[model samples]
Target: MTTATLGRLDAIDPAARRAPRYGGFSWTFLSVELKRLFRNSSVVIFTLIFPVAMLIMVGLPNKNVPISDVPVAQGGMSAAVPIMISMAVYGAMVASTMTGVTVAAERTQGWSRQLRLTPLNPVVYILVKVLCGLVLGGIAVLITLILGSALGITAPVGNLVLAGLLAWLSSLMMTSLGLAVGYAFPAQNAMRYLGPILPILSFMGGLFFPLALMPDGVQIAAKFTPVWGIANLSQSAIIGTAPDVWAIPNLVVWFLLFTGFAVLMFRRDTKRV
Candidate 1:
């Protein structure tokens, strides 16, 4: 080779050539994911429309019904308050779990394999999925809250805001659970198995009604369910009561459990590829 060609060859770093490209998280990728999510009309219908509709149907008649003997000014809230919050939680749960559909689709399309070929860390990829789920969940909660306000579900502004925050935070576990299910099942089967979990948990956790109204057996069981703590915590502000002492720990433990399960499944899927 000529001297100039030899110099050019020598300047190229072997280490750089061997290193993987596109290794870290990027906001651009997150934005693309969000946009892709919103493009799905089903997501909008299920996460936004359904919840608001349920809130109106259930909350309108109960708007003036007092939840307890205490007055609203003295800390008691309307029946509509809990109904509104529960529907919000329900919507958020559905939105978060929809992550499974996207993940399974990616796997089916060989996108997971493509990602594996890049320097992108698997954990970062999973984090991006979780964030997308959270964004969808947040939107679900917000839309429900706006509808609730219009339907006359009144409460202190602080309580309303706090309840909304708690409802959004409660979706973290659902996001991780969605990732776990997505990584565990085939594309077509992922959502089929995942769809009924939230509604069942909501019923058992007394999100649809007071635990006290449940049978003695159900009330006891509700205390141990994944949704119970977060549901109670979210509603406590509106109810003007202290949440159970176990609420925080319950939320933390379930989040860790789901996150761990998701990581394990992700590693397994990666290895399979």
Candidate 2:
């Protein structure tokens, strides 16, 4: 072989220098996604700031007022305490679920095609997106908790920790629900549907209002909503009460259902491509 030809082959040789793998959980990608998310003014205001502001407005002024005949789970706890917990869950759910909306946008931009060309695993990509949502949700939770504490929404340390844990964990349901919605609909349509559905679900789940205060039929129906079980658990944590045994089944069933829906949608997309 000619010396020039040998040099050209050497320059192009895969054995000489390995191509960088794009697979796995990438911190660089994570950072980029986070920055992208934070840069969106709407996302920042809606997901991170709004919940805290709401708590301050509604909760701070009423911090000292004792809510009479609050629910059994609320025990002797001040109304502000339960409101803070619910808002934390509400914020976390919104933040995490909204992450799925990016999926719809990415699909519209053919980002999914670009992703398929890389070494990144599809599952890892999904996980990263979910993690981004979780991060935002966690930020909202922390901010709400800090503001609550500052505004005199007091609870035992253990109760605070438990409430946070339950609220955060329950947000996974919304994350999956968002993913399913994103995969099933166009970007604009996904958000449109979500805008109305979110508040409705939150209301039905008793995140915004107490199920105990609702009519008997509404209270019975609230049990079927995805947020109800987790909200109850969080409320019980704050009030130092035992969660109902039914809460376990409620959370598990809805989580699995949402997760399954997401998986089905993802698989359908893959088949189409």
Candidate 3:
């Protein structure tokens, strides 16, 4: 029989391992998350079908209405055009809630704790969750896009290619936000209260209403929430315009803040010897 030797594994600094270690997370983990996301009827109805319904609701009767004296050829183009952006923002918030529930549920099932016991780096575990959530959120966005196209909902000036890029980057920011929430709260109780949080933020997001319509100071403060900034950028893009420079920076800052918070919490959790 072959003999093996064991030594102080923990003492062998984690940095020495050039390649990363992971919890039970792998392609298997990602596939499972995707499958589970689809299986959840509420997620399907809310994140998936709800946007389509909203699109149709807004697209209706607007076919002959002019939004702003601009010939909307076959369109109000949906004054609810902003709702596409709003829908995405809404979905991402749901992503945060849903992903947090995913992690929390996984933890309840002992997946996270067991994975932590692996050779996997804590950082890798956190990264994978965030990446997985981003992918899920991206898929949801694509579904919304498909519905918009089928409904004859025109995408302002943005070509599909440009819009895709915007969605990818915005999803990246949102993934980080989701992770931050996932790390901050205990999974179970979070979901219980998280349901209400989305609508409040969506309203605060200024998606249904223009920030200009709000008080000046509220508009300024809304910039701190990544949702507001992305909503502004996406709405402008859909309206056939480029977002202002400041808007991009707002997204970047929130992205960094969320990333930092998530990493810090995950690292602390892994410190158990």
Candidate 4:
């Protein structure tokens, strides 16, 4: 070996050297999955096009009508930037979840078995796929936020960055949610069933609507929903209001629960095949 090569090898401690090999399966899976996504035109529609479209379809001009979940703003969708920004996030989450679940349906086509047969560990494969969802979801969130800003909707750029960061973090939690439900279905029809249902929940979750407009009891219930916590955390960033610190513990618990469920479900699915 060249002296430079010897020096490079010596510079890496044993732990550092072995870490990459240990994580190689996940890195390769992330790369290959990303390549597959880029090559597929239809996948583009689901992950990219649809998300952007949703933002424009509902968010742009936002001049059509206005409403506010906050009593102070009581109007239509076009009135409140916070509520408007949330609609984009809600749409993106629904789209991202549906996209992940549809990928699970490919499991029946022999592709799943073939991938599993490769050196990639099942856990690593799942992790990489989930991470891929995060990547696309983060992009979707950014586009939605930027669009919200451009359309007469305004906020401090710092506030916008904070909102964007919250959205990205929330997307990771959504990735786990998607994986758990997607794997649980074990087939495509479940995704079909799920495709429209969760978005409806968003209305109650206060995505584009205010809980204030709902019954007080119902509004209290909404506060407990996973998406509600996420949206609340994000809105706090936008309005420059401090988020309820309690939202953090609730979010952490939900993320952990969803992740655990996803692992259990994936393991069961693997054992069956």
Residues 120-203, candidate 2, lDDT per residue (tens digit)?
665566667778888888888888998899877887889999998888876677888898899899888998999899889988
Task: Report clashes for each candidate as comma-separated counts.
Answer: 0, 0, 1, 8
lDDT of 1: 0.83
Query: What TM-score, computed on C-alpha atoms, does each candidate reach?
Result: 0.88, 0.83, 0.78, 0.77
TM-score of candidate 3 relative to the true fold: 0.78
lDDT of each: 0.83, 0.81, 0.63, 0.66
lDDT of 4 at 218: 87
Candidate 1: tens digits of C-alpha lDDT, residues 1-273: 899999999999867765434557788989998888889888768897888888988878887777779765566678889888888888888888885467888889888788776777777777887889889999999999998888667788888899898999867888888889888999899988887877788888778878888899988888888899889888886666789898888889988898888888888888889
- Top TM-score hit: 1
- The C-alpha RMSD of each candidate to the native structure, in angstroms, is 3.6, 4.5, 4.3, 7.7
**Candidates 2 and 4: which is better by lDDT?**
2
Candidates arranged by TM-score, highest first:
1, 2, 3, 4
Q: Model 2 scores what on Cα lDDT?
A: 0.81
Off by over 4 Å in 3: 1-45, 58-65, 74-78, 271-273
Worst 10 residues of 1 by lDDT: 14-23
Best by lDDT: 1
Q: List the residue pairs that clash in candidate 1.
A: none
Q: Candidate 3's error at 262, in angstroms?
A: 1.6
Error of 2 at 214 (Å): 2.0
